[model samples]
Target: MTKKMTWNEMSPSQQTGVLVTGSIQLALAATAWIDLAKRPAERVNGPKALWAAIIGINFVGPIAWFIWGRRR
Candidate 1:
């Protein structure tokens, strides 16, 4: 299900709000990487390897939500 979305219809504040939220969440998501790294400690896998997994979750979910939410 979807609704039509028009960028022209959104106020500047709406766009700004999305951007601000995205950036703040992005920063916080880095912590998820830190959390992931800790899990691998004392194991063979490197802590930094978790960075990829963390970034994947961090970026994908919100992007999907924002894009779909705009349509509605």
Candidate 2:
């Protein structure tokens, strides 16, 4: 098994990359959730509850929701 690197062990660039990626993930999920909440069931392609769950699936989920889950 390989040793896991902690935040302190990460290089500055790696740390920045991680932070940026994490922020993007958080923003995407938040946006998807907000859109899902404000959008009606009829407007969404699937159940809002299911989309809400899918939104938690990191990058792919939110992107998929924006591209396919919404009726528009």
Candidate 3:
């Protein structure tokens, strides 16, 4: 899995799968973001201000993960 992979090596479905999964996660975070006030107390205390950070870090995590943390 460490080997670098070109887009061509991934099947059409595989490519779509990665995109759809990432998109879903992005959408969920964006949607959940709207209701920070409604956020249950637990998340507030833990992910708390962390979750409530401006959209900047919220997105940066995913991008960083994709670039530096990808299995390959």
lDDT winner? 2
Q: Can you rank all candidates by lDDT, best first?
A: 2, 3, 1
lDDT of 3 by residue, 1-72 (tens): 599778899999989998998887777556545555565654343454554554335566434433432233
Task: Give one clash count per candidate, in the order shown.
Answer: 0, 0, 1
Runs in model 3 with CA error above 4 Å?
37-48, 53-72
lDDT of 2 by residue, 15-50 (tens): 999999999999999999999999989999988899
Candidate 1 residues lying further than 4 Å off, grouped into runs, are: 1-4, 34-72
lDDT tens per residue, model 1, 12-33: 9988887898887886556544
lDDT value for candidate 3? 0.57
Better of 1 and 3 by lDDT: 3
* Per-candidate local distance difference test: 0.53, 0.95, 0.57
Question: Weakest 10 consecutive residues, lDDT, candidate 2?
Answer: 46-55
Candidate 2 stretches with Cα past 4 Å from truth are none
